[model samples]
Target: MRKIIASLFISLDGVVEAPDQWHFPYFNDEMGAAVDATLGRTDTLLLGRKTYDGFAGAWPEREAAGGEDAGFAKKLGDARKVVVSGQDLSFTWRNSERLEGGLVDGVAALKREPGGDIAMSGSVSVVRELLAHGLLDELHLMVHPIALCKGMRLFEEGEATMPLRLLSSTTFRTGVLHLVYALAESAGDATYDDAKVHLPQDEA
Candidate 1:
């Protein structure tokens, strides 16, 4: 099964909304490379309606003078896109699809298909639902060195406790931290034979 990987840009205070307001200052060569690496791993882009609108509006008309930005825009334009929305609006991007059915069921079915790993970015709401449904496979966060202190946080209050295991951590030259994590094995979901729980017959 293909994995659903989510990459989020969050502040020190956990604010993920409106990254444009505070994300550019922390971006550097290392961070750009990290983004490239992520794009190389996936051909499908999963986005919420808001994020999709933002990206679709910008990436198509963006022009760069021979840099990673140009390349990234091109890659984003070429990648297959699926938006989480109730409206079946006409998508201007190529190879775009809509998830009008229930969100969890639609995304789960997409994961079951044989394809490149699905990647999501800037879709906080969709990512939240994915986590709540236990459908997200991997999470990569670029933690910037600032605090919005009032925007939408990635881990909002009243959400279930999600346990994750740290896979790797890398700090960029610009003080941006790239951290990757996967779901940890929950105690209840952990497989252990009850018969093997007995103490061994050894000298004590």
Candidate 2:
């Protein structure tokens, strides 16, 4: 099955919305490389309507302008983009389509199809739904050092708890932490005593 991976830029306070306002300052060569690595493995782009609209509106123009970002814009324009939206939408962007049927069922079907990894970005609702249904395979969070205090968050109150295991972590020079995580197979039954093994002991 093709893995569904989500890459999100989040603040220390867990805000995932409006990254454009606070995310760029920490973007550096290392962060660019990490994003490129994710895109390298992705063949399809799964996104929510808002995110889809934002990219569709900007990337094509960027590609047409033919500048430093043009290459990346072209890459996005060429990818198969699947947008999750219930409202009727005309996807004018190249290779773009609206997801058919229910979100969960549609995405589940997509995963079973033969393809490279499906990559998602800036779709908090879609990401949350996938995580709730145990559909998201990997989650890559670029945790910035700032606190937005007010914005949409990746995880909100009254939601069921989900367990995740850290796959890898890297800190960029700009203080952004690139943390990769996968859904844990099981929430381990370790207790405080089990964790005590790692504590430093005083010499007798």
Candidate 3:
């Protein structure tokens, strides 16, 4: 089964909101390389409605001369997009689908499909839901040097204890630390037999 992975670009304090205070300040060679590398590995994408709109509006207009990242944005625009939202809105992007069945169910279905790894980008709400449901297999977080006192978070409020193992970490020239983590197996409840649990692989 393919793993469900989430790639989030966060601040040092875990803020995942609009990093670029203005429209064009966040683009740099390091960021471009990072974005390019991440996009090349994955073909499927999951996004929140707001983020979907954000990319839909910006990437299509970005010219190739903007930078390597703009070229990457064009590549992202060509990939298949699945947007999870309950609000009724029109999507004009090619090869895009609206996930109206709710985040948890939609993701579960996506996990069952036979395809390349699914990457979640800039969708904290969807990411939080997947984390809460124990549906995520890996998390790739790029923690930037800056910290925003107030912004959206990468995780949600909940009581479920999530154990993670750091698979790898790397620091870029721009001071962004890329941390990769896998959800650790449950240490409690020795009686939990995974085979007899009767959960679908996708649901698991």
State residue 103's C-alpha deviation in candidate 1, in Å: 0.9
**Candidate 2 vs candidate 3, TM-score winner:** 2
Residue 170 of model 3, lDDT score: 79
Per-residue lDDT of candidate 2, residues 86-200 (tens digit): 9988988999999987899999999999989999988999999999999999999999999999988999999988999999999999999999999886776899999998999
Report, for every candidate in turn, its global Cα lDDT versus the true structure.
Answer: 0.85, 0.92, 0.75
Q: Write the per-residue lDDT of candidate 1 for residues 89-146, one digit (tens) a residue.
A: 7988777889746798999899988888999887888888888888998899999999
lDDT of 3 at 189: 65
Steric clash count of candidate 1 = 0
TM, every model: 0.86, 0.94, 0.78
What's the C-alpha lDDT at position 66 in model 3?
A: 80
Give the C-alpha miss distance for residue 39 in model 1, angstroms: 3.0
List model 3 lDDT by residue over 1-204, tens digit each. Answer: 557778777888878887667213444676666566666467778888888888888776673458645666667777778888887778777778887567787778888889888777777777777887888888888887876878777765564678788999977776778898888877666454855667655644
Give lDDT: candidate 2, residue 171: 95
RMSD for all candidates, in order, please. 5.8, 1.5, 9.8
TM-score ranking from best candidate downward: 2, 1, 3
